[model samples]
Target: MDRQLAERLEIFERTGQVAPEICRFVRTELDVLDAAGSEITEESAGTLTSHLLLALQRSRDGGALTEFAADETVRAELAGHPDALEQAAALAERAESALDVVLPGQEVRFLALHLALLRQREAMR
Candidate 1:
């Protein structure tokens, strides 16, 4: 992990704004992305990391976004990137298993959109 991301994770962990499990999940997910040759860095994955942290925290607190409406444009974009969608769903499943919280379908779709964007950006480089 980059210094900036490590520092941010430390702050969240120390402040208790995010649970230890969530932090661990974020680290693990980032590691997975790195190992998969995604060239993940704090700048690249910051938003996705934040989103995952908040999603996990909300799920654990019973404040999960149950009424999320999937954006059609994003859905259409993801349809062309089945691999990203599948990878995002798998990552979400890991988060669910790690934190013992279920993510709604819309949340998974949003995650897929983010993942697809990240991969697309990386591909552009």
Candidate 2:
């Protein structure tokens, strides 16, 4: 894990904003991404990390988003990047297994959008 991300996770754990299991799950996900050849940096993964944390917290609290209206334009954009969508779905599945929580399809789509955007940014650089 990146030092900055580890520190951030520590802060969240210390502040009681994130459960230890959630932190561990995030760390494991980062490791998985790293092993898959994706650059796991604070800048590249900060938003994704935050989103995963919040999603896990919400799941634990039983406060899932009732409806997630993904923008059609964004969905269309993501549709062009099937690899990202597949990766996101795989990650979501792992999260479900690791955290023992079900992530709604909308949440999965949002995760895919983040990944697609990240891939686009990386390609530009």
Per lDDT, the best of the predicted structures is 1
TM-score of 1: 0.90
Off-target runs (Cα >4 Å) in candidate 1 are: none
Lowest summed lDDT window (length 10), candidate 2: 65-74
* lDDT of each residue in 22-116, candidate 1, tens digit only: 89888888888889888777788878878877877888898877765546767887889999889878887887777787887677777887788
Shift of residue 15 alpha carbon in model 1, Å: 1.8
**After superposition, which runs of candidate 2 have C-alpha atoms over 4 Å from their true positions?**
none
TM-score of 2: 0.87
- Candidate 2 residue-wise lDDT at 119: 76
Error of 2 at 73 (Å): 3.8
